[model samples]
Target: MSRAKGNLAEDKACKFLDENGFMIIERNFYSRFGEIDIIATKDEVLHFVEVKSGLDYESAIQNITPQKLSRLLRTGDVYMKKNSLDVDFMYDAIIVTPQDVELVDNITI
Candidate 1:
C-alpha cells in the first residue's frame, strides 16, 4: 500500500485503540526483521498491532500472510527483550475498510 494509505490506517487504528482503552505506547517500531505498526497497553497486557487497510476486509486481511506474521513475531520478540517486559503480550491486527475498522487479537502465525 501507499504511504498515505498506511498513515491513514495507522491514524484510524490509533483512534480505535485509544477508544478501546489501550494506552498508546509507541508506533512504527522497527527491528532488523521488520516493523511493528503499533504498540499499546490494555490493562496490564501489551499489544503489538498491525494496521491493514483496503477497500474491503477480504483484501485487507489477505495482506497478513504467514511470512508477515513470522516477521511480526520476530520483531515482537525483539521488542519484549529490549523493553524487559515479562508480562503478557499478543499479536493483533486492525483491519480498516471503507465502512469500518475491526480489531482481531491473539492471532496465530
Candidate 2:
C-alpha cells in the first residue's frame, strides 16, 4: 500500500490503542533492521506494534510474513538497547480494516 494509506491506518491504530488505555510512546521508529509502526506502553510493558491495513483482516494480516516479523524483532531489540530499557516488551500487530481496528498482541517471529 501507499505510504499515505499506511500513515492513515497507523493513525487509526494509534487512536484505537490510546482509547484502550495504552500510552503512545512513539511512532514510525526506524532502525537499520526495519521500522516499528507504533510503540506504546500498557501495564508497564512496552509494545512494538506493526500496522497493517487491507480490505479485510486476513489480507492485512498476511502481510506480516516471517521475514517481516524477523525484521520487527531485530528492530525492537535495537530500540530497547538504544534506550537502555530492560523492561518487559512484546511485538504486536494492529490490523486496520474499513470496519474495525484490531490489536493482536504477543506476536512471535
Tell me the TM-score of each prediction against the true structure: 0.97, 0.98
TM-score, predicted candidate 2 vs. hidden true structure: 0.98
Each model's lDDT comes to: 0.95, 0.95
Give me the candidate number with maximum TM-score.
2
Question: What TM value does model 1 have?
Answer: 0.97
Model 1: per-residue Cα lDDT at residue 40: 97
Worst 10 residues of 1 by lDDT: 100-109
Tens-digit lDDT track for model 2 on 1-109?
8999999999999999999999999999999999999999999999999999999999999999999999999999999999999999999999999999999988794
Worst 10 residues of 2 by lDDT: 100-109
Clashes by residue pair, model 2: none
Which sections of candidate 1 miss by over 4 Å?
none
Compared with the true structure, the alpha-carbon lDDT of candidate 2 equals: 0.95
Query: Best-fitting candidate, measured by lDDT?
Result: 2
